[model samples]
Target: MSVGKRAEPDPYSLPVPGLVRRVRRIAGISQRELARAARISHGVIGRIEKGTSMPTLPVLERILGVAGLGIVVVNDEGRVIRPMLDRADAHDGADRRYPSHLDTILDPEPGEWWGDIYGLARPPETFHRDRSRRDMQRRRSQWEVRVARHRHEPPPPKVPDYY
Candidate 1:
């Protein structure tokens, strides 16, 4: 155990074995060499690459550091956005606020009402609008039924019958 290590480790959201293999190949190092560099057993590296075992965050960081590559945070569209702040930085300092344009480019704000200069609120070629329309249309019949029922229903008696 290291000086400051969590007893229970967090699981990875993304596939890391693939990434380890990719970076290891890019670094042009064998599993054994990578293990040596990261100070972990070669078997551990193999298991990590084979997806049999998961490394702790520190171990993964060490392995990635040795491969001359690091992890990146990405948006929903698979575009790399920014690296996470270090643990120390996470505790202190003002949030790194990006400009509006960068937000538009990297991660657009949700529910942005207006269309852009391109005259499209969203890209026309995307299937999202089509899917949304289909979903709404599918539910439209049910909504229309409710609306019709409300319209046809007689108004409550001017004098309440129960009262």
Candidate 2:
């Protein structure tokens, strides 16, 4: 996507790239200028502006700080305004709130618990069994092919050395 283009429509609010573009326009800064001021690469800024990359809290803060802006999240009633300084806080509580026992069973390190719970926390034993079966099939195929050598195969031709 081109820089300064919004990737999606927002039902209630502007998407990140649109907001970034608006902020940049209000600050009277170009993409290159903003990247330099934010001390980030132009490509990163372009990705952010194109809504392809979601910057981390620190990176977003730095970029927004350059434009005298910060990410603000509002409640449904618009009565509460919360600055989005923590990435974890961005998740919907229903999707993220784990049961106490499950959380204890999968004690993920900070900032590392966002992956699929089944795959990341405790993968099924069948995963290794499937991998071993696939490996055996590949090796059996190679052995079968090697054993089926053509009897009429031609011999290698010799090449003369150049002076």
Candidate 3:
């Protein structure tokens, strides 16, 4: 064996490629069949499995959905984690999510919220979001935090408080 070379890194890592292939395998369908069922081009499915290209979230969801497989967010314990609901009137008049960093003030006193122009009829909530505080942590970092929590380990270094 040649000992002077490092292993080739997987082009797509474990998530997308493995997910696409595994879903099709479990559903007992060929890539062509999956593409037909998902109404996507067969080349796209092949590219995904070959790690030559990455599919957008919607595209992957469509393929998985066609295979009767749905993506679920889960923790280290493998239990399905429900996403945060927008039930507390989290959306504005445009039905867009407000910034998550700032506190959401529910049942606000008039000046407590800036969404008055949206003409909400006594909205159940409002966000006093500060635009400057963009706490947009990457998904990888957030997943690391969840893994730490599941392992009963201390959280990794806190993202600096920008305030």
Q: Estimate each model's TM-score.
A: 0.41, 0.40, 0.51
Instruction: Give the least accurate 10-residue stretch of model 1, judged by summed lDDT.
Output: 98-107
- Give the range of the ten consecutive residues with the poorest summed lDDT in model 3: 131-140
CA lDDT of every candidate: 0.60, 0.56, 0.71
lDDT of 2: 0.56
lDDT of 1 by residue, 1-163 (tens): 1235555634654588998898688789999999999999999999888888989889989998986776677665999897444432222125543232211222333333134434665521111223333344435545556776657654432321111
For residues 32-91, what per-residue lDDT tens digits would candidate 2 score against the true structure? 888888888889889888777877778778888887887666655886674424334323
Decreasing lDDT order of the candidates: 3, 1, 2
Candidate 3 local distance difference test against the native: 0.71
In terms of lDDT, model 1 sits at 0.60
Model 2, TM vs. native:
0.40
Question: Which RMSD values do the candidates have, in order?
Answer: 17.4, 21.9, 11.1
Off by over 4 Å in 3: 1-11, 75-80, 87-98, 108-163
Q: Pick the candidate with the highest TM-score.
A: 3
Better of 1 and 2 by lDDT: 1
